[model samples]
Target: MNIDEKRFTASTEIQKPVPTKRGKSTTTWFALYGFLFISLALFVYVTNVLLGPLRLLLFDPPLFLRINELAIWYSGIPLVIGTALISWDLFRNVTRIRDAKFVRNDPPANRFLTVALTAYNDERSIGGAVKDFRAHPLVKRVIVISNNSRDRTMEIAEQAGAIVFNETRQGYGACVHRALREALKFEDTELTLLCEGDLTFRAADIEKFLAYIPHADVVNGSRIVEQLQERDTQLSLYMHYGNLFAGKVLEMKHLGAVSLTDVGTTYKLCRNVTLRELMPLLDPRINLEFNAYFLDTALSAGVRIIECPVAFYPRVGTSKGGNVNNRIATRLGLRMLWGIFVDWKGFFHD
Candidate 1:
C-alpha cells in the first residue's frame, strides 16, 4: 500500500473507540500516591547515606541533632498521607478491564520486515550483525544508522549489504529515531525491527517478536529471563534488578495498562504504522534513559505494548552505553526516575 493509504488506514483504526468502564481519576490518584510514598522513601534513604557523614563532620552538634530530629518526625506526615490516599483509591475503585483490544489474531499482511540497527563505533560487530539480520528469511532489508562513529562502522555495514546512514546527532535516542524514520520509508515491509549493532542481540529472536507483535502495536524484548541471558554478558545482577525495579515503576504509572520487566532493552519490533503515529510523540534528546522514556510515552499515548523474552549475549566490542559500569547505570537509572516523576523535557542538556 502507498504511504497515504497506510496513513488513512492507521488513522481509521486508531480512531475506533474502545469501551472501558474504569475511571481515570482513580488510576491517576493511585499512581500519584504510590509514587509519592516511594519517592519519599528513596529520598530519605539516599540523603541519609550520602549526606550523613558530611553533616556530622561540618555541622555543629545542635544543628545536626535538630535536622535529624526534624527529618525523622516530618517524613512520617507524607507516609501517612500517601497511605491514606492509596487506601481510599483501593477501597473506592472497582477492578475493571482497561483494554478492550483483546488478543488480536490479525497478523501483518506482509511477513517481511525492515530491520534497522543502531551503530556507534561498532566496527568490530557491525558487519556480522548486518549479515545475520540480512540472512533472515523474513527480513526484507537491513538498515544501519551510525551515530557519528569515528570508526569504520559505516563502511563495514555497507560492505555487509546494509543501507547505511549517519545520524550526526550523537545519542542512542537519536540513532534509534533515525532508524525508525528510515525504516518507515520502505513500502515493502509492514514491520520494523529496531536493534543495536553491538551483536549483543541476535536475529534469531525475530521469530519471538513476530509471535507477540500480532497481539500489540509493539513487542519489546525483555532480557530478564535467566535462561536466555548468557553468563558473561554485560547485564550484571545489579543492572538486572535495577531494570526490573524501573520497569515496575513505569508499570505502576500506567496501572492495569501494561506489564513491563525490562525497560533497558534496545531490541524491539514496531509496526510501521504505529511508528508513524508515535514518532512525533517521542523525544530523542533524552539520552541514555531513552528506552524508558519511549515506553512511557508510548503507553501514555494509548499505544499497546507487550514484552517478549529474547536472548542476551556478550558484546564483541567495548560498551559505550549505560551498561558500561555500575556507576553509569545508577546515574542513568536516577535520570529515568527523574523523567518518570518530574518531566522528560527537563532531561535535555542541549
Candidate 2:
C-alpha cells in the first residue's frame, strides 16, 4: 500500500472516541451564582472606599450612620453567600464533573495547514509576517484578511505572495471571522491556524500547536509563560495579570471542564472540521472582547480546548487594541466580565 493508504488504514483502525456527557447542571448553577455574589461584594467594597470622604462631607450624623449600616449589609450578605456556595461546590462536586478518563489517538494523517492572518493597517509587519508563515514546510497557503486597512497592508501582503481579502465589517472579530471563513475554503488543508499580522507571534510555534492538536479540537496559544515572552511586548505586567484573572474566572465558570490561561491572545489552531461546526454559533459582532466570547461559547458547546505555550514579542506598529493603555484594558476586561456573568448581547450597549 502507498503512504496515503497506510495512513488511512491506521486512522480507521484507531478512531477517536466521542467525549462522554457529564452531569453539569448543578455545577453551572452554583458557579454562576457564586461568581455573581462575590463580584457584587467586591463592587460594594470598592464603591465604599471611593465614596467614604463624600459620605462624611454630605451627610449629617444620623444619615451617615444609616448609610454606613446599609453599606455593611450590602457587602456582607453577598460575601457570605458567595463564599458558601463556592466552598460547597468545590468540595462536593468538582471532581465528579471533571473528565478523568485517559484516551489517546493517532496523529493527524494530513499535517499541512492553511494559515489566516488578521491585518488592520499593519503595513510594516504584513510582508514579513506573510513570508515567515509561507516558509513553513507544513503551511500550504498564507491568507491575509485586511479589516479595511487605510495603509499598504493589503498591497504588501499580496506582493509577499499572500492571498489577500478585505473584510469591510470593520472590527477585530469581523476580520477574524472572515479569515476563518477564507481558510475553511481550502480543501487541501485540514488544519486552520489563525493569528495576527502584527508579528507578535511566529510560524515556528506551528510545531508546538501540531504537537497538541491530537488531544483537542482547538489548541489555543498561551502567552502566560514569562520565559517564553519578550520583555518589551504589549503584554505589560498589568495586562498579564489581568488576563490570568479572566482566565481563572472562565475556568471557574466551567467548574471541572477545562483549565485555561491567556484568553486575550489571538494565536490559536483549530481543526477545520471543528470550525465548520462552531462558526454558526459564534457572534462576530462581539468586537474587542471576542476571544473570551469564543472560548466561553466553545466550552459551553463541549469543544475540547488545550493551551500551548507560544513566544510573544513586540508588535511592529502602534497598538490599536486593548493593550494601548491600562484604562482601556480595564474597560475591556470589565466588558469580558459582564459577558461572562450577565449576557453577551448586553455588550452592544457598553
* Best candidate according to TM-score: 2
Best by lDDT: 2
lDDT of 1 by residue, 79-182 (tens): 77767766665454435433354555457788798999999999999999999999999999999999999999999999999999999998888989999999
* Candidate 1, position 113, lDDT: 89
lDDT of 2 by residue, 183-219 (tens): 9999998999999999999999999999999888899
Q: For each candidate, what TM-score against the reference?
A: 0.82, 0.84
Mark the 10 consecutive residues where model 2 has the least summed lDDT: 18-27
Give per-model CA RMSD: 8.1, 6.4
Model 1, 326: alpha-carbon shift in Å?
1.4
- Model 2: runs farther than 4 Å from truth? 1-27, 39-76, 91-100, 103-106
State residue 264's C-alpha deviation in candidate 1, in Å.
0.9
Give me the runs in candidate 1 sitting further than 4 Å from their true place: 1-29, 42-80, 88-101
